[model samples]
Target: MQNRPDLPHSAINPQLVWTGFMAMCVGMFMAILDVQVVATSLPTIQSALDIDPDQMSWIQTAYLIAEVVAIPLTGFLTRFLTMRWLFVTSLTLFVIASAGCATSSSFGGLVSWRVLQGFSGGTLIPSVFSAVFILFPKERQAVATTVAGVLAVLAPTVGPIVGGWLTETYSWHWLFLINVLPGIAAALVALRSLPREDINTSELRNLDGLSLVLMAVSLASLELALKEAPTSGWISVYIVTLLCLSTASGCAFVWRSLHRTRPLVDLDNFRDRNFLTGSILSFVLGIGLFGSVYLMPVFLAFVRGHNALEIGMTMLVTGTAQLVTAPIAVALEKRVDARLLSAAGFTVFAIGIAMSGFQDPRSDYDAMFWPQVVRGAAIMFCLLPPTRLALGRLSPDKVPDASGLFNLMRNLGGAIGIALIDTIIYTRSEPIGRTLLARLQAGDTDAATFIGVPLQAIADHKGALDQKTMAMLDPLLQTAATVQALNEAWIVMAVLTGCAILCLPFARPVAPAE
Candidate 1:
């Protein structure tokens, strides 16, 4: 068979290749860091902006909802816009949004700006993957992915530490402002270094708009339902209605794609066993990943009475360990089947989660380190191989679509995981708190005897009791309940991680390298 001569030669300049790779890395770092940085800084933002707890979550939810909806459209959008144009536009939007976020005087304004940032940043992962694939040949693609992987993994891990420091020392605004410089640099480098490629307008015109709308609606509805389900009652009628609508919309999307000549996303890709299996694994991993990330800091802050900086420092260790192990995972990939490696990775992650389950309020930094080390190494193993296995067999033309779907599922999994953990914490915490309160009431005669100047007065007209006395008592009761709730949440996460380990057998072995 005659090979196509029109395709760019694999013998491109190494320096240019590195430059493009670094640009993609910079873009990814900006996107991911923005998300993680905000996690640690959320408290500061809440305090500065005087955000209610219920509304405070919108800061994260708005970004995720926008990002999720935008991700699936990457396949279609890339066909119309050149990579350079897309990267530059996205970076510009992200930078501007960051400025808006930093300067916003109200919580609503910050959330609105975050939505814009999410929309722009959503295009970044697919763009970076496409750029790396184009710059390197088949053999060296692993190396390229590894480099990108390191940045991708490290960004989220270090985001909290950086964000915490900035919020503690400077202000929460610095978290967003810090991205402006990197965003500008990435846009400039992308404009100068990325090679021009031929684009087919005919292909661009083939995009199915209806399917795009359906996908967006379905994902957005489902996310809204999940986010609210925790606090609004487990299966409220409103949630059920949204779930049904989301499901119907999703089905319609699949049905539409199957019939259309050039659907926004080809439904047939799911037929690939490896893709299907890898996607499932990715979803489960996402559950573990985001669930743990979200729960840990909250546990540290609310239960252990740690400040933002202390919590960030604890997480920083795991992030650093993951950074150190990323290259080693890549090297091992050369010699091992990705499936086996992934399974091993899941095992390590499960162990880490299990260890974390044992933590109490008194647990120190040393107690946290080993589990994080395991988790760091585990994530590198899980992230790289499954990604390779899922996309490796795809034809070059379908790679972009596959990447889009892959990332979308991962994000969806994260959303679901967060919802699940949040639900578990809420549902279980209350009952556990009540039980603890009852026990404390029964066990502490002194607490029971004081009565705090008559039960009726305390319950109805408590102005008589000193505010300082009430405040002091409130902390003791709250601390005990918080401890109980955190312990339950940790156990739930550990169990989920264990279930993820069982998914390894389902992953097909990577074919022997040629």
Candidate 2:
């Protein structure tokens, strides 16, 4: 990251830096968008392939497992490869894999390509964060990171809109195919415009085998356990066994990493207090970000019968809020305390989520506006400072390792957040149904509305209610219970996000405005 006065000007010139940075942003947007895009089209894909529901989940799972497993390895790869090659290779591999996925004729073929795409996609993400600190000088980085922040926030929210249009207007195959042109363009730009750095051939020579195996196994097992925990029941033998394997392998990896002469990743980066606080914040942010995204889309599509495009449109408010906030965040970071900015951000975000926790069955996009705006506007301040806290202050040698771990923690939190939210809804559904039933049986007039039944109508047909009307009773009850469950999930997330505010005090202060 240190400037090399002897290097060619094209590598560090203002124009090249901006182009290279924009290319990385395109690559990042494509990679993140692909994850959520495919999610929206899963049913169409399953139907097109004639695969069973059980087997269909694996389409997503395979990609996720591969992605998570490759994320931590980016640190090791950085030792031998410059940022340019890393960007070029990842985009190339991702493009080829996307083509394969688009043309896949069988279930197995698609899954194989997805795994490759996922690994390549994983490498694209951390590279952007690495680029922020490496390619640009500290004087110029705030604007660069603001741009990255916009991509990071916008891509996930806009994914459904893009995916729905492509899938509905065309075919599910178009989802993967969409990445090809952008991927090629990004790779070419990065290869041509990005500055190169001298590689550490000696560090490359000491790549540890045992640690890689353990990390791969641990992360893969952990991802599987999280994915399956809700369906299998957290206490079921299948989930328990996988968790145990993950823990053991993870412990073994840490042990070997600490003892190795040159570990794949430098484990000592966690010793930095700023990095530690940043990582914890990253983990919590993941829960808030992924958890809300998962919950909102499901609520819209399932409870309200909204299409993917409609859901995407509703999510736009959040993105717009984030877009407006990015510049303010950039301008403020130079003058404000990082910890205070982060605390204010999380506090506002938590309040937004908590507001949504009170939504009823009648709530729609109109009802969702303010909360979405609050959460959206808060993302910049929340993410920017923590990122600065985590990698901004690290020595050039430690930035890679710290970046890897920082991003990895966020992904892990997301994996765990989705599973926990699913589990809570399942466990609460039946109990909430029972409680509603008790109130109805006891003749509580208000309880009748839980099933959309009028107290007067029930009284009018007390003994002569038709069989057709009775059939709807179960469906109505289930709907009511689900709405209640979603409310509870939002509340829990709000509390979790609110608690993140407490971590702000632990963060090392940002350097004062010059």
Candidate 3:
């Protein structure tokens, strides 16, 4: 056979390459899907488990913290366990954890299972991207990456829709139960097909125990503070203590990573301008991506009085738009300037999210449609190209480390983003409550009318009805306040996204590697 160095390389067997690729995508889909799918049924789960509404946020927070903490260590885990064994172990652990979550009768038990699920599920995400760089030839990287990108965006997009239907029709347990079959099948396919690598136990010799400890503590405390900040008071003793400790630990973790020889994974990737720029975009992408997802469901279920099924069906619009844009994004990736694409993506996404800010109290399926479409179309351009900038053309040896760090930034951004928005919703509503109550106290008839307090009788029955008006008006006012807060949060996201344009110049185009 003639050797042609310039010709596209088919380095691995086609059957194994695609089978293993699809398997990873399935695992990625299942894991990402699990997070979003259960989001809608959270209220139902809280009710069923008899969990306190105050601590219910922990259900999502625990998983996010565990998942994010595991992300940067992916390079380490991949070194110790090949993609094949890692996926197998992670899939197995994920399946077991899902089953445990479904059957758990207590809050603690469910949360414990979720933590394990997060750690295992975390590995699957970066591994899918790592696989794209390592498994596919440069020529086909775009197509393969697009497939993974589609699943990543698609799963979350459909998650609530599927979750709402399942929870409304069957039970909340079905959210976790749905993962078992697919998880098992993905594991089986990956086990049979993925090419194996020898475990590199030598990579852990220095371990950097302090970095690992500090990393875990830092991430955990940060997530806790975010989750509790809204009600507990952002500057309260508990929130402040957690934030202070997290800051100390995070500073120490960075110091240890920079000074230590074999840091957990490379923090050095950020020194690269393109990598750093791409990372910042990824972080903002997380805020918009996870923030929008989190906000919409709450807005729909809580404010719009929509059921689980309706929220899910509406969310499907984002996913559907993503499908439409995937090919265009991939095509443009080759011909267009990457930094421009990123700028355009963030700009387009910001506009999309801003569209959501105009939502009314009566916002419904039709009202949310255009915003989801704009966001969905913009998702591909936001995700795929930055991925290339962050992970593309790296030394094969650096691929794992780069991918791990890259994905970690996005997830961490999401965890923090969720907390900020939660704080926004909690804090913003309280003032509105106080302000509205004051209006009533000042004998403002509009306040009474707003709450349907029969303003006609207010003057005559001022003494009797003042107390009654407060009681009647509280829930109605609270709901309005929440809608106002969500609108503010959407505007904030749009502004944050616009700021990503500042990071645009650093994400310069990387020419295709010959």
> Of the candidates shown, which would achieve the greatest TM-score relative to the real structure?
2
Per-residue CA lDDT of model 2 for 1-514, tens digit only, reads 4322235334568888889889998998888899999999999999999988889988989899998987888777776676777778988999999999999988999999999999999878888888787777776777887898789878889988888999999999999999999999999998878876666677667878888999999999999999999989999999999999999999999999998877887778887888888998899898999888899998898888999999999998999999988889998888787788889988998988888887666678988999999999899988888888888888766776777788888889889889989998989989988887667656666768656777876676653546775676667777778888888999998899889878777777787322
TM-score of 1: 0.88
Q: What is the TM-score of candidate 2?
A: 0.95
Clashing residue pairs in candidate 2, if any?
none
lDDT of 3 by residue, 372-399 (tens): 9999999998988888888885766667
What is residue 472's positional error in candidate 1, in angstroms? 9.0
What would you estimate as the lDDT of candidate 3?
Answer: 0.83
The models' CA-based lDDT, in order, is 0.75, 0.85, 0.83
* Span of 10 residues, lowest total lDDT, candidate 2: 1-10
Global Cα lDDT for candidate 2: 0.85
Q: Candidate 1 — what's its lDDT?
A: 0.75
State in Å the error of residue 23, model 2: 0.6
Q: Please rank every candidate by lDDT, starting with the best.
A: 2, 3, 1
lDDT of 1 at 40: 74
Clash totals for all candidate models: 0, 0, 1
Q: Model 3 clash pairs?
A: 161-312
